[model samples]
Target: MIKVKGLTRAYGSFIAVDDISFECRPGTVTGFLGPNGAGKTTTMRVMVGLTPATHGDVTIGGLHYRDIPNPGRHVGVLLDASAQHAGRTGREVLEIGARTMGLPGVRVDEMLDLVSLDGREAKRRVRNYSLGMRQRLGIAHALLGDPSVLILDEPANGLDPAGIRWMRGLLKGYADQGGTVFLSSHLLHEVEQIADEMILIGNGRIVARGTRDELLRDATGGVFTTLVTALDNHQLAEALTERGLVVHQAGEGLRVTAEPVDVGRIAADKQIVLTDLRAGHEGGLEDLFLELTAETQRDVLPNDMSADEVRA
Candidate 1:
């Protein structure tokens, strides 16, 4: 298990991570999500000892990462897929890692196969490998030790849809077999699909953390928004307001803070002809993510802005 308590990282006057605390337990995948520069990478680096924490602590299995013997054998990490030696072949990369961990040579073949990097592909120089292939090679190296805990950053960045699906299943199976997986990504849908729990961060602090359903429940506050359109839109709106439901004009319909069934019942009682009625969570987790991180998200330039103004 990974435990972080009041973890904070500072660079002079600028604070990168601020007093954040969370846990990644065994047999579960914890997704650390945030917009760019929200401190997700800094926190992960501190956890693995690449960066020093200005305050607080992080421990893996009750021991700091630096204190662990041959930490890679216990905690597999792939912070940057491109950080591997560019002069070596993909096979050479895993061979070095396996040798450092005192694993047999056959372990290299196993990992290459596990990540689906064929013998021919493995022999290719790291510099010649595409971003997607580099990612695969990096994953192969991370799993080469068969560690109990894996920490990856944006593992799906260069993967295609099929590769992403493969990775999702691979991590799911790893956690199912009692390993801990702590990965960070900005890909909302992929994380929503595979993460057992999620930690959302913005402006160097955690905004929310919980299971997908739990976060959605908290965001909606037990009141789901329903979109409805009726032949007599004015009558339907009045009836919904009379029933104590908050209603808003949405296009040619009404958006209400009530369930579809409840809205249907209200329309039925008012003898209104309904044209449409459905829950308004079509955006799913993406909506909640954007809402919580709105302040941190970068503003798009106005379309009318001149090129010189944009550069300026």
Candidate 2:
């Protein structure tokens, strides 16, 4: 498990990571989420001892990263995939990692194959490899030692759809085997699909942290947003309003704030002919992330700008 206590990092007076604290437990995937330059990279760097902390400390299994014997065998980290030796072959990169961890050469081939970098791909020099290939190579090396903890930054940045799916399964299986996985990624859907818990950060501070259900529950407002239509629109709208439910006209239908069960019951009671009905939770991870980090957001759609405005 990874425990961070009052972790803070500063360059002179420019504070990058505030007094933040969190834990990445074993047998689960904890997603570190934030906008660009939100101190996620700094936190991960502090975790691996790549950067000295201004205050507090991060530990892996009750010991500092540098204090751990054969740290690679205990914690695997991939801060920058492109940091690999450009002149070295893909296989060579993993070979060096395996050697440092006192692993056999066979482990290099195994990892290369595990990440689908075998044959010609593995033989190619790192400089010749594409961004996606480098990401795969970095992942292979991180897993080369079969470490108990994994720390990755933007692991899915350059992966395609299929590669992303494969990575999801790989981390899930690793966690199932009692390994800890803490990763940062901009792919909200991937994080939503794979993470057992999530930590949201903004402006160098942790704004929110919880399991998906726990966090989404707070964002959902306990109200289901539903779209429904019936044969008699005027009659249905009047009946719904009289029943004390808020309804509004929405593109050939009505957007109502009510549970699907309640809506169906009301329709059945009124003997209305329903043509369509769909219910969904209006807010999700994207919505929550935006809300928490809106002030820190650097890029945004202009309030009065659209395709029409741009063409004018």
Candidate 3:
């Protein structure tokens, strides 16, 4: 397990990470999520000893990373995929890692196969490899030691859809076999699909952290948003509003703040013909994320700005 207690990192007057505490347990995939420059990378760097923490501590299995013997054999990390030696081939890179860990050379071949890098491709120089291929090679190197814990930052950044799916399966299987996986990403959908727990950060502090259902439950406060449409959407909207439920025009339907049954009962009492009604929690995570991090999000236009002003 990975434990971070009151972890903080500051550069002179600028604080990069601020008193954040969390845990990444074994046999689970924990996603660290945030917008760019939200201190996710700095926290990861402090956890692995690349940067000094101004306060608090981080430990893996009750020991600091620097204190662990041959830490790579116990904790696998791939913070930057492009940090590999450009002069070396992919195979050569893994070979060096395996040799440093005192593993047999065949272990490198196994990892290459595991990551779907064919023998021909493995012989290609790192400089010639595309970003996607570099990510694959980096993953191969991270898993080469078969460590119990893996820490990866934005592993899906350059991957195609199929490659992303493959990565999800691979990490899921690894956690299933009792490995701890701590992944970081700015993409909501990618983390939502695979993370067992999520930590959302903004402005150097944690805004929220929990399982998907738990976070959504807290955000909605037990009141679910329902989407409904009827033959007369205007009538349905008026009826819902009359019932003191918040209603908004949403894509040819009315988004109401009430249960489906409540909306249905109102529609029936109003003699309205309903066409569609369903719980609208599918986008709850995205909505909650945007709401919580609205101030930290980049390049957002002012709501009061006119279209002509924006064009100007």
Please provide, for model 3 over 1-312, each residue's C-alpha lDDT reduced to its tens digit, 9 standing for 90 to 100: 999999989999998899999999999999999999999999989888999899999999899999989988999999999999999999999999999999999999999999899989999999999999999999998898889999999999789999999999999999999999999999998998899999999989999999987888877787788999999999999998998999999998989998789999999999999999987787788888988878789968788998799899
- TM for candidate 3 is 0.84
Per-model TM-score, in order, reads 0.81, 0.84, 0.84
Candidate numbers sorted by TM-score from highest down: 2, 3, 1
Per-residue CA lDDT of model 1 for 1-312, tens digit only, reads: 999999989999998999999999999999999898899899989989999999999999999999999888999998999999999999999999999999999999999998999989999999999999999999998898889999999999899889999999999999999999999998788898889999999989999999987887777776688999999889998999998999999999989998789999888887899989987764757778888887788864566997799789
**Better TM-score candidate (1, 2):** 2
| Superposed Cα deviation of residue 276, candidate 3 (Å) | 10
Query: Which residue segments of model 1 deviate by more than 4 Å?
Result: 224-280, 299-312
| Per-residue lDDT of model 2, residues 181-204, tens digit only | 999975667897889999998888
| TM-score of decoy 2 | 0.84
Say which candidate scores most in lDDT. Answer: 3
- Model 2 spans > 4 angstroms off: 225-279, 302-307
Question: What lDDT score is found at residue 41 in candidate 3?
Answer: 95
Off by over 4 Å in 3: 225-279, 306-312
Q: Is candidate 1 or candidate 2 better by lDDT?
A: 1
> Candidate 2's error at 60, in angstroms?
0.4
